[model samples]
Target: MQWIAALPMYNIAPALADDWRALLGAVLGRISPWLDARGDTVRIVDPGADLTAFWLRDDVLLSQTCGYPLLHALSGRVQLVATPAFDAPGCERGGYRSVLVAGAQAGASSLEACRGLRAVYNDEDSNSGMNLFRHAVAPLTSGGRFFSSATKSGGHLASLRAIAVERSADVAAIDCVTLAFVRAHRPELAAGIREIGVTASAPALPFIASKRVPKGLVDALAAALSDVIAQDEALAGRLRLRGVLRFTEADYACIDRYEREAIELGYPRLA
Candidate 1:
């Protein structure tokens, strides 16, 4: 079977999709020759909204996934390729945080003051969008409830739009990387979204693969990813790319800790 390479997370925004594709194409350019030498072929693909089907297929030569699913849903189904380091604010090394945003009502206010308001999130399985946000509000919940309601906006951009444009939700949590991208490419779109606070940090989404990719090629892929950013300064700047870092799955145990801590605090859900 032919293999696939996709960076689904940051690639979702239409404003930034071409930039992601450029970087993906550059990385693939460096690595595809190696694949051809080994009698293998790979192509770049857009996995669309729901990634469950894409991730389940063993042909996932390369992909990115959130820490929540890396621990909860994916479990042992996929293995790490490498972690991409970002040069955005609220990012350090290869870890990133989520920024809690709101409109005029909650502007520059404390989380406690924003109680009983509606909240939007990218997805329940999203570490930055939901897991970290849950941990941030867990201590403020009463009787296992915090927001008057919590709804899924499907993606980080949608969450921001709900809070800023439609005004259907009072607040939402978005990953630092996506926030940085929006601020750079769609600054006006983010003018109304105020950053009230930020959630804790964990490994930014990680590159992953199934058994379809060989160990040698995985190592080469990681090295190529790390080197490409340095060799192509323009791509690096556009992608806000720093470099790639090697991480064992153990490094992501903190995700489980955040979830456990929230549960212990009586906030079992992001409601």
Candidate 2:
């Protein structure tokens, strides 16, 4: 009955990570009572922990995972808890979109203008970074290639920096929530970065528990998340969480469809 929790997606800037982690801890703490015996000893997974591995661990009581992985990689291994509604741009009804950003110096006025340039992504498994990016450019590309070169930056913020600061890449797809957080907290990171385009929307990442957990405990986790804002609106605001909403497996099927469409269109990869 090992239990671990993590929220890696929204905690981008290091200055806010500790406070954000504490807030997450408190929200989970508030739900302790409802979890019955299962909540007695929940540990926060280290922020630096490898989330990809954490997604596969049997001890994962709660974690936030991208919609792409939830369907393709961790499909039968995890159970959905709830989807957090964000009070940020590009977020609606528990779904979010990605922004295509290019360096101001690059002088690319539009996504169409940035073709055949070096591009970076958080990871191939990322929905906002890769999947949605591919879908957005699929119809606009030729010969199944979009960029002259494609590289992996490993994280959203890093992808932003790669284009905005390092100038190593001409453009990259970034999660809207991550970009909003940076623009609000540290505008300098967004310096030289301009949003040239936006990707199609998809369900926000989901809160999940390993399938090893009992159904009763999973239900309790969902109940707690749904009532978190009501339990403590102030803390919820600090965390940028508007509310949690119910989501079904069917709600995430669109992610797989994005992949299929990309293949069918003959632009199966983002460069």
**Best prediction by lDDT:** 1
Number of clashes found in candidate 2: 0
Candidate 2 lDDT, tens digit per residue, 151-257?
A: 99998878878887888998888888888889987687798798898988898889888888778778777777757666777767766678888898799899999
What's the lDDT for residue 13 in model 2?
Answer: 66
In candidate 1, clashing pairs total 0
Q: Compose the digit string of candidate 1's lDDT tens values, residues 85-177.
A: 999999998999999888765554767777888898888898998999999999998899988899998888888878777888888888999
What is the alpha-carbon RMSD of candidate 2 to the true structure?
1.8
Show pairs that collide, candidate 2: none
lDDT of each: 0.85, 0.82
Q: Model 2: what TM-score?
A: 0.93
Give the range where candidate 1 is weakest over 10 consecutive residues by summed lDDT: 104-113
Superposed Cα deviation of residue 224, candidate 1 (Å): 0.6
